[model samples]
Target: MRPQRLSDVVGQQHLVGPGKIIARMVAAKLLSSMILYGPPGTGKTSIASAIAGSTKYAFRKLNAATDSKKDLQIVAEEAKMSGTVILLLDEIHRLDKTKQDFLLPHLESGRIILIGATTENPYININPAIRSRTQIFEVKPLTLTDIETALERALTDPERGLGKLPIKLDDDAKRFMADATNGDLRSALNGLELAAQSTPPAEDGTIHITQAIAEECFQRKAIAGDKNGDAHYDVISAFQKSIRGSDTDAALHYLAQLVAAGDLPIICRRLMVIAYEDVGLANPPAASRTVQAVQAAQQLGLPEGRIPLANAVIELCLSPKSNSAMVAMDAALTDVNAGHNGAVPDHLKDAHYAGAKKLGHGNDYKYPHNFPNDWVKQDYLPAGLKGSEYYQPKMNGRFETQLAEQYHRLRKANQ
Candidate 1:
């Protein structure tokens, strides 16, 4: 059931709590268009509706991906008559250019206090025009305590929630629902409803929702998500760490958990990242194979796709790990970002132009390929960073060891 007041909304205290941004905005009567982004069942819709209810404004909810431009025009027309209307635009990231252009002027005039909602990150997926005009607020997953509170509220509230029904939710069943939901309050409520409706009324006319009933209502998700879904982010974090730590068993365990949750894309993407970020230059070939494996997994889909993914995960686990490449690149980036850049040497500058010789470009440049060893030592870095070194080989793998030997030899030759 949707909440009519912010007080009834669960979790997301950072945005809706009494001194928070949303609360402060509503208090000061200075409502600005904002975006609420997070995973499913995080109360993004509830907050939007609650704000509208509290402000006594006409609340309109529409999916940007499914609703037509005419649907938005209807809301705009209503806003024109009502002075201001609160619109909860779901899947705002999918809003097309035409619909966005139509809504832009209304948002600008404060006639439509748009509350855009999406599971995707607004900064990455939303159009710049809409994003620039709206404030972005992240709705966090509901905690177990938060879910329990909502469940209890639903059980007792006579209106909106299932209160009139004689439902008895056991403590174990309530906890099971909360833990199984993985912070998704909507899933928990839906599962509870299914259990309540499916179970036969007891002799006392009470619908008993026991732990077994909860499990049965949840089906495969109940048992499979027992260990994984409760801590989805934790499982993902542990999955990468286990691989990086070379714990093949632990890594595979987490992989299985992610698969059970049906998060193939996240698994594939994370595996690719782990290949480069964790099992990096120490074994370049392994990293390359990980990318190929991710591509194969994407094509194959789950079940069969998991086969190549398993191979990649195991190889990455056993592969030698080195962050030397990542570290070196980060070091260079840090300097560049901090404005450590200096003027390039004239000899190293482009010398293909007609007046190159006159400008002293490439005049003193030595052609390394023409030298005795097919190499020549020269200042390639800018004058201020002439002796700067970034690449530090860990030499964990044979390939890196050999490369390190050659690298040190060349440095010695120059010295």
Candidate 2:
């Protein structure tokens, strides 16, 4: 049975609760085209149906993957005849440009209230034109309490639920189903219905659902992760941040999530980037070790691959964090982009070219190798950027501390 009203929606109270966006829109009788995005079985379609039922508007359902242009034509015709209609389009990310072009005018004219639903991120998967015209809302996964409440309603409601069936669900069974579905109400309800229908009633004329029966119905809850969706980027971002923050446990947790999702290649690549971007200078050896670990993970592959990945993650997390290198590069790039095209000094220009001495190339250039410590005070930057100090090393670790000391000493000697 579908939700008949907004209050009947299981979760996402942020959008459907009193004084929420959907409730405010319904109260004002002003609806706009919107896209509902989230993992599957998260009440996107249910919310759309509930809105249509409550508003008493003509409602039509179509699948973007299977429906043709003729289906949209029919909906457009009906909306014109009825003055308004709400169309619930599923898998909206799959809608081609042709269908988007067809729906644009209707959406703009306020004749068809479009409720587009997808399990993909709209910003990444949808056409800009379509995304710009619609407000996007994220429907979150249902909590265990919400799933349990829905199951109870289905078992007792007379009109559209299994009220006539004498199904007696034990407390353990109810909790098992709620927890086994992993926040998916649809899976919980379907499993409950299956157990109720197939189980033989006892001598007391009661169909008892036990923990074993519930497990049989729903084997394992699938982890919600889409490699091409927002979840992938979100996990990767969390992983990097954890490492940068020096939180070893948090970094390992996100690493395990990616490992469980079987995205080893992405994990390896992200680890390498984090080594240089977040762990640079402070621990240069960490960068080298990270590169080697990634190579090892790639060669070993899977179960065995996770070991090397874990080794790299722990090393990076515990290593001193530094963004000085990243900042230095960005500062230099900013000057280049700002048209700071100062000519190179003759002494610093390419001197190996033929007849270079005639142009004064390499003239008066101090050879660092010829001096004490194999170093000399020299101008390497362009003429306009003289005296610019970009590499400011942070003294967070022993290596960087030594480097910073040497840098200050050299600057004092040059002065």
lDDT per prediction? 0.88, 0.87
In model 2, which runs have C-alpha deviations exceeding 4 angstroms? 221-415
Error of 2 at 100 (Å): 1.1
**What's each prediction's TM-score?**
0.66, 0.60
In model 2, state the lDDT of residue 216: 73
Best by lDDT: 1
Candidate 1 lDDT, 239-271, residue by residue in tens: 999999999999999999888756686798899
lDDT of 2 by residue, 216-244 (tens): 78763222423222454677899999999
Candidate maximizing TM-score? 1
